[model samples]
Target: MDIDARTLRTFREVTLTGSFTQAARRLGYSQSSVTAQMRALERQVGEPVFERLPNGVRLTHSGIVLRDYARQILTLVGEMETALRRPAANPPRLTVGIVPALAYGQQLARVTHIGRRLLSGVQLALRIMGTAEVHDAFKAGAIDGALVLTVVDADDPADLLGEQQYADRSDDLTEVRLQEVEFVPVTGVGRRPGGHGRQVVIADPDCPSQRWLPEFLRLRCDSPPEIHELGSMAGVRAATQSGLGCAMLPTALAADHEEAGGLRPLPGVPRMRWNASLILGRHDTRPAVDRQNLTETLRQATALGRAARPAVPAAEVLGGAGLGGEVLGGGATALDPDTSIAS
Candidate 1:
């Protein structure tokens, strides 16, 4: 079917908001007009796109299928527009995939540094996705590079495909250790003393913490504590602040919430360390000058992360294989003194 850009845009809006009325308000169209547009698009595609349920309007299976293609088409269109407007002297674009957990202050600082210095005229697209999705995207050539946490053993074959690190490894990629933040269990401020009864909220099962937390809890607690699986750190913090339960969160996040009187760390819980890393494919053919400039920008960004309180260890921030056999490179040089913080 030949769906126009306008129709696809409407469909996307409705899909995101899950309400035709809300989408209409955002799009500045009458509800009737929005409904008519969706109906017309459905007719063109010869299928029912949405099904109204008690909670909200949901995409039908057909709608779900079309949405993927629509996103790709829109992305291509955006790329075309950018290419047409870009200056001839500008460097080629660098597409970087990052995990959703890394989309915060320190990460923003790095992106800003890159934008101002190394990536001056170059387009730097930061795509937020899950760690697994980031790895898949890198392998599929959907992104030129990424910044994500490493979970699999350093010696695993997948780990060696990019650059390699103990905590955050990849094979043929340039690796930079960002920061080693620790997670701690936290609860609402001024709450009761019976901390044992408190529910423990966790991020989705896919998160590294979730995979490790069960084992830690099993060993530490007398019995299984109530568990709530949330999609984001914000949600977990919110739940804990409302006295819903205890949450294991990054020290940085817990500190922010504690300052706001929303939460406090549960005393006696051991902190667990996690690291972030930057990964770029070796086969990527971007210009040498551009790569050098980008690398410098990343270093500055990571340095900012290190400067934050609770100084992280440089050794903990690695770029080679772990006990497993993931080799970073045959003769890759260590990070320079100017860029890397001393372990």
Candidate 2:
């Protein structure tokens, strides 16, 4: 039986979302269109694909088998489309979501240069956003891929993206571990002005590095820090520069400001380290192979960014507060694609 790509795509969306109305909302199609497409797909297969229920739908045994093949077929079709449509002169553009804090400094420049040299025809469009925003955007297909720091706790459901749905569907997403990042406590020039608990400035509290920070700090500091939340990394930098207490930031970010006296590392404060990974698509869906290829290029580009920056060892900044070789928690796990970088 010959099945159209659009019908297969609709089927995949329905399978992922579990509800016709929800799939329609995601695909910008009417519920009627979704039902019509599902009917057409079922007719093509000569069997019912979905066991419709009051709350949602479930796939039949035949539907499960079809979805496995459909994912592979769609991936191949996507590759074919790219090969056919890509311009000879201009490379296809890729949208990549990154932690907003990394947007500035030597990292951006180095990544851009590496992309130009290594990625050949592909252009990179980087978006700076918080972790939660990154997850949502990727799920909505707003970005082609992402490099993010996620806290992995085997017991915590939030640590694993779409864990429930991922287990229920055929596994096809690409995940690759890059490298670890060190987080350090930073202040302006000196101690807090009032001698009260240091005011803690954080750009995004939901950032994986920042998630356990308050409790982490309570272990390190005498009094609990007075927390101050800001909207952007720039704002956090500005506030910390004005002696707005202490903040935990990536060593790279703190390194950027150190030479100019914009920030001073708190020598005795604890450090947090987490692994960064390049993830394509959501937990439930596999990314197109072209996107996965671009993801590898992007990781190499960022690795170049790290190498280009002047190295600031974590030991130098953490001083006595360094955890040495210890990791905070068991870091994230990845099911890697066919890439050189190990998970």
Candidate 3:
């Protein structure tokens, strides 16, 4: 019997979710379609894979055995694909997706350096997107890799690119530390207090920082403040600096404003720290040689970026900077030194 990859994938998803409806939701298929796929799979296997119950579904004995083999088969197929797709003579092009905030920092420089030195002839394509969008694009084969801040809870270890740590724990997602970020609250310079009330601008509502913002506010302030949600950090910062509201700005990016006395953190509001990660699709088809070079380039760049900047105070780092008013680096300022030093 000829078994297809799609059938295996469908079986795996159904097994994982234990409900065709849930599996279909995840796979972007209809319930009927998923059911049909499973039925076809069972026909091929000559046994029932799932037993339908009023509560949900359960895998039959054969289903369990097939699942284990299916996983192994898929993994082996992926490895084979990776091995086969390695470039021979010409260099391979690697497309990398990045969130706007990550694209602006040391990541850009590091990726560029990797392309120049290690990747040599390889072309780099950078796509700016949110973490969710990046993940979708990666899974859909739209991009080869990404640098994103994703929750660790549901992420498969095999899908992750490297080491992980807890950045923040929330109801839906556990923010993992990809890279240390310094966040500062900022408002326009010379703006009179109470002109527009206290406005808090956030990036996307789904952004990890934004997700944590309300909780942060609840802990810090008793009263509910007006909140503005923007699509991008740039938008939030711009709105805040226009005297529309106050925003949590990356320490590195907010340096100029801070130096010019345009932005300042609210009194008793602590510096926020978050983690960033380099994420890549498991199916990235770059040659092994190219993958090694690119990975090394990013690793070195991240290390250098981390080393060059002073560690933000643990309190100021994320949960709170501290009551002492110590300055921590996060935004464009942190990267400026690296650029100048490199030049």
Candidate 4:
């Protein structure tokens, strides 16, 4: 019969309570509405769906059979409505650019896990690049976003901008500064200069340490050791652990090697401080297909603290609870929609 979902639900409710009045009350409908629905339901089936009693009512033989089919139809209708209401199961792919050092660090492992939960239905890809390559990737539109590591130094303000020349294009981009990451000089235990540890293990080209380490080493040691470039973090760690050379690595990675007694900090070498900032294409040119989802991803990713500069603008305040029961929760990002580079 041509019964609708609303009528079927009312019929099901009436059968559940065995009283039209009670069903109406529970369904938040007037008793007349329930009576009218039942009438239409019976009329469509050409038989009474309920047998009236002096007390309340009972289901007829046909009513009992109709009840089963009504429940199934209502369930199918509910499933259809939910499917139509939800956002697409897939959106445009989100390409993120990251430096080898950060990508290899412990924090990044956490970020990627949480970011995926935030960007729920979207495809995410990471492009491993050095500090300098990220700038070019963003300019060429090869990447949708990036996590850039900036050296935070007061005396050398240039470290803030460094190879990220996009600081000049304030209208084109915005950066949300994450927590500071510390880098330490580590070498295999008991190894010294002119040995396997003499050679410095570093990421190939464009790593900030590549420029600063040589001079730092020359001043600290009797004779500076040779530099050997390793492309991956695991390789660098393995090499350092086996006395291949001293590598400057994030404290988290370095601490792991130290705990095992396979590595130790180079004596008298100061730690380097860098800020992990998330870069986004700003304004109308923003590449994210689903702004709301991307905003939530940023919010969950930076749940640690508020931005030191301008705050997230003109969006719902979804606090950073870090992938709660609601994986596809919506929220705003800390990137100010209209940001100035000087800020």
Q: For each candidate, what is the lDDT? A: 0.60, 0.62, 0.59, 0.61
In model 4, residue pairs whose N, Cα or C atoms come closer than 3 Å (at least 3 residues apart or on different chains), thus clashing, are none
Error of 1 at 199 (Å): 3.5
lDDT value, candidate 4, whole model: 0.61
Off by over 4 Å in 2: 1-91, 152-158, 161-174, 193-197, 219-224, 282-289, 304-343
- Badly placed stretches (over 4 Å) of model 4 are 1-86, 153-161, 164-171, 193-197, 221-224, 287-343
- Give model 4's TM-score versus the native structure: 0.55
Worst 10 residues of 3 by lDDT: 334-343
Candidate order (TM-score): 2, 4, 1, 3
For candidate 2, the C-alpha RMSD (Å) to the true structure equals: 14.1
RMSD of each: 21.7, 14.1, 14.9, 19.9
TM-score computed on alpha carbons, candidate 2: 0.55
Local accuracy of candidate 3 as per-residue lDDT tens digits, 114-180: 5675555577777877655754575578877666644333345532321232222122221222445
Q: Provide backbone clash counts, one per model.
A: 13, 0, 21, 0
Find the number of clashing residue pairs for candidate 3. 21
Worst 10 residues of 2 by lDDT: 334-343
lDDT tens readout by residue for model 1, 75-114: 4554454456647775566887765555555566667665
lDDT of 1 at 316: 31
Q: After superposition, how far is residue 188 of candidate 1 from its true place, in Å?
A: 2.3
Give one digit per residue, the lDDT tens place, for model 2 in 163-224: 34333321333455565566666778755433323467877666655544554455344346
